[model samples]
Target chain A: MNVFKLNSWSPYVAGGMVGILICLSVLITGKYFGASTTFVRSAGLIEKVFAPERVEKMDYFVKKKVRIDWQWMFVVGVFFGSLLSSRISGDYRKTALPPMWETRFGPNRARRWVIAFVGGIIAMFGARMAGG
Target chain B: MNLLFWGLVTGIFFGFLLQKGQVLRYDKQLGALRLSDFTIVKFMLSTVIVAMVGIYFLHDFGLVALKPKTTALGANIIGGLIFGAGWGLLGYCPATAVGALGEGRWDSLFGIIGMLFGAAIYAEVYPALKTNVLAWGNLGKITLPGVLGINHWIVIVVLIIAFCSLFYWFEKKGV
Candidate 1:
């Protein structure tokens, strides 16, 4: 019972809960578990701020809209919760380039960002086109 | 606003579970790629199986509509390859990237930015994709039971058994 106070839960427990959440998500929203679309919505949100015309012109944006939704808030919550814990544990140092990325991609922040950006596009694009 | 309110509550719980699952840890994600850690696999597999059973049953009972996406083999293969390449380069999937950033790693911001740009591009090209890559294989909203022409419950039970066995092995191997 006190295990609820622990930093991490057993994978089974957490995973099971996520599964139940999936069911609830479908029941409540009529959608299964989705995360990729949030990025697209964010794109619309950002673009509308900069170029409202471009967002209006894009068919996908026109259909999906740019409002904050469940998954977006879910991601935000994930972030704030982590921020709170990391702050409490005093483990919140910022790294411009993680050494792991540097050892492979080299010490260039720009290059890393480029690859990451490309990766996000590829992943989301594939997920969309492939129906994954 | 009611739906949105529930959404906020759901997000808090969802985020809490993700954090507690420890799948947000950099080393755990890296290990998953390396095939050394089964934490992500365990978590995701469990999530999938449970969702499959729950959603399917709910749909069967007419409690919800099953909005299964079409099965486009060409799009799947090509898109998956492209996605894999990007994921390999980025070092974390989209969800984990957000979670990692929240954990104060901040290194995942690049992937998030990439997602924004990628999503923007995807929106513009989506209509064309319908006729091209997305049209390939065109199996209209078919499920495993639909393909095999059997009861979904049967398939679900078999999958659960299979997953449980895999879980047992992982535990024995001390993953």
Candidate 2:
């Protein structure tokens, strides 16, 4: 079978791999794999650039620390890894919007941006509030 | 350096799996939210079940330590609702957003930017929110096993059964 193609794999296979990764992650780092925390941490780092004093005073920042930790690197790895996977699979494309989105939202780049941004904001807010 | 290396390695594998599983696809995510496609749901459920079983077994064998986070009821309910809403709208969670970006879906950038903004907003309001809403119903570091005083394996079994039943229904419904 060709290892490089623009097609999806079985969900069961992917999930199995993820399961192994989770177990390994815990064994290696005693933490779960999550992306929201990294985003929140990045926000803290950015806010620190503007208001170092205030950001430091914030309890969340103080507790989590606005530094590039393992999770930060993990997220970076994810981005690059995905890029690598797409390249290897020959599925890499520079599309602004996917077809599904175009059909539902009428092919407007600005609309996609707005919806994604607002949705991201809402999702992150909930994630942080819930300690996700 | 060792820890960082391990994190990167594990994350790469996880990211690969996510991309392979089609979790980064906007359609799959939106479909899962709409109850139209069960691909993402099945992937996530199976992941949870497998991880849970392996985790507790490892813990039992004294190979790993279990550090479950506190179950903050208020935070969970509020955050879950908002997260679900956002997932429906953007068809991207924090994990899938970056994965999609890596796949060269430039629209994913907006969601990432929004997530950063959202986190900043949460930080800005933390001083007030922490004392009131965020701290509500704080069930500290409680797990199902701990709460029921049962073996972790039992909880894992139950979760597997429940998830499998759901998966069967999803298959039957063809959604």
Candidate 3:
């Protein structure tokens, strides 16, 4: 079967593949299948360009160090892969906000951004504190 | 060979899997949180079980050292609460945010930017958290099997059975 042409794969098969990925991730690159660190390091990389002094001062950046490492490229690859899938399967839809969010949270784009931003902060902090 | 090539490949496959699994949908994410859909849970649980078996097997063979982080109750509890809050609010976790973007959902951009700042903020407070919240209930590096003083496979088997049962129940319930 041309998996790429299909609109979706059974969750079970996808899950199984993702599981093997966790193992392959370690075996090939000595890293686990995770995406949070890429966001963190990318933050540092962005800051380093604009405010080198601030980047140096930030303890997290000092520890994590800003570089396009394997994880970073992995995330980059994720973006392209999904883009490819959506493009192939014709499931891509551009939207500023989902209907559910608007219905539940209301229709203010600014409000949505604020909430999403706050959510990001909380999620990242939680992920870091919990270790990866 | 570039060290990143393998990671990129891994990520590409992972992305494809996530997309194919249809977990990238906002409604699916919201549904998972609302208990209206079991798709996300099954997918993630399967991955967890699979990884559990594979990682431990590889470790047993001495191919890789198992580096389990400390089981800090405080960090886990507080961090989990905070994480859930963000995830619920944004309807997109870090990985999903990227995938949503790839699927042409522009709103996930807010989450992407927000998380970047969140990381910065976490860095600023790391020192304080290290001595305080992060130190709470620090149990050292340990796993469930290790804590139980049993073979890892035993725990893995039990978890697999339990999860399979749960999946069966979900199917029965039409979830």
Candidate 4:
């Protein structure tokens, strides 16, 4: 009956819920669930600000044809939805670093940010290379 | 029905599930990457099984079409390696990072920002990257059934059973 812990559900149940969501998505829209596409589109949108023609002619953007699409909105919804869930369950709390992170990586905020940024760059590079 | 509406609605449910499933938890994520925790893997395997079966059923009913992404051996292996490294380092994916941000883990923001910049970098040099890396071992759209030349149902059933057995074993091992 712990309000704070109520946010945590059995992995199986949560996984099932995700499955159901995916099922509904495909059943209704003929699209699979993905989030990386939003970042790509966001990047494309930003690129248009500086080099409009380059972005316009880029084969990647040409194929994707960037605008705020369902994926971007969907990702935004995920953020808000998570906030709502956490708020309702009393699990929402501001923390600069999770305990595990501090214990493993030490309490160096700058280092954490640098590693995360570099990792993200490498990861996204791979994602696009894989056409994700 | 507009697809955007569907995306918004489903995205909410998806976020809720990710939060509840503890996939947004840093410890759980790190453990999974380190092979010390099977919880996330079980969750992901269950999701794949469900989606595989459910999507096939929907397709059979003529309610949807299955458009599996193209499989490129080079792309998958290379991308998977980098993604795995990043996951091990940041302990978050694009989806789970959003969930964690909602839960108020500010550090997750760094990873998110990095992801955005990374995406920008990829977009900037996409033409060259596409030609050199993306074209490697390119295999047109494919699926398990197509690769194995078996019925989708058969693959689904087999994978379901296999995953269930693995799940049971993992639970017993308590890793």
Candidate 3 lDDT over residue span B1-175, tens digit each:
4778987888788888888898887778888999999889989998988888999899889886677877889999899888888888888888888988988887888888989888888887887887889889988888888789998889999999999999999899988
Clashing residue pairs for model 4: none
Q: Reference contacts recovered by each candidate, as fractions?
A: 0.67, 0.75, 0.76, 0.67
Measured with C-alpha atoms, the lDDT of residue B22 in candidate 4 is: 76
Kindly list the per-residue Cα lDDT of model 1 for residues B1-175, writing each as its tens digit.
6666666566656666776787876567767788888898899999888888888889888998888777778888988887777777777777778777866667688788887788888888988886887778777778898899999899999999999999999999998
Candidate 1 residue runs with Cα over 4 Å from true position: A81-114
lDDT score for candidate 4 against the true structure: 0.81
Candidate 4: regions farther than 4 A off: A1-5
What i-RMS does each candidate reach, in Å? 2.5, 1.1, 1.5, 1.3
State the weakest 10-residue window (summed lDDT) of model 2 chain A: A1-10
> Model 2 over residues B1-175: C-alpha lDDT tens digits?
8878877877787777788787888988888777788899889888988888888889988999887888878888988898888777777888889889998888889999999999988887888887888788998999888899998788888888998899889878877
For every prediction, compared with the true complex, DockQ reads 0.58, 0.78, 0.73, 0.71
- The predicted structure with the larger DockQ, 1 or 2, is 2
Candidate 4 structure quality by residue, lDDT tens digits, A1-132: 764359688787778778878888877777688888888888888889999988888887787778887888788888887887888888889877767888977988898888877877777777776667
Assess every candidate by TM-score. Answer: 0.87, 0.95, 0.94, 0.94
lDDT of 2 at A126: 86
For model 3, residues A1-132, the per-residue Cα lDDT tens digits are: 777888888887899889998888887678876788887798888778889998888777778877888888888888888888888898887878887888877778898888878888888888887776
lDDT of 1 by residue, A1-132 (tens): 555456777888888898999799779876555677788888899889999987888778877778888767766766666555455445556767765566766787788777777777777777666554
Clashes of each: 1, 0, 1, 0
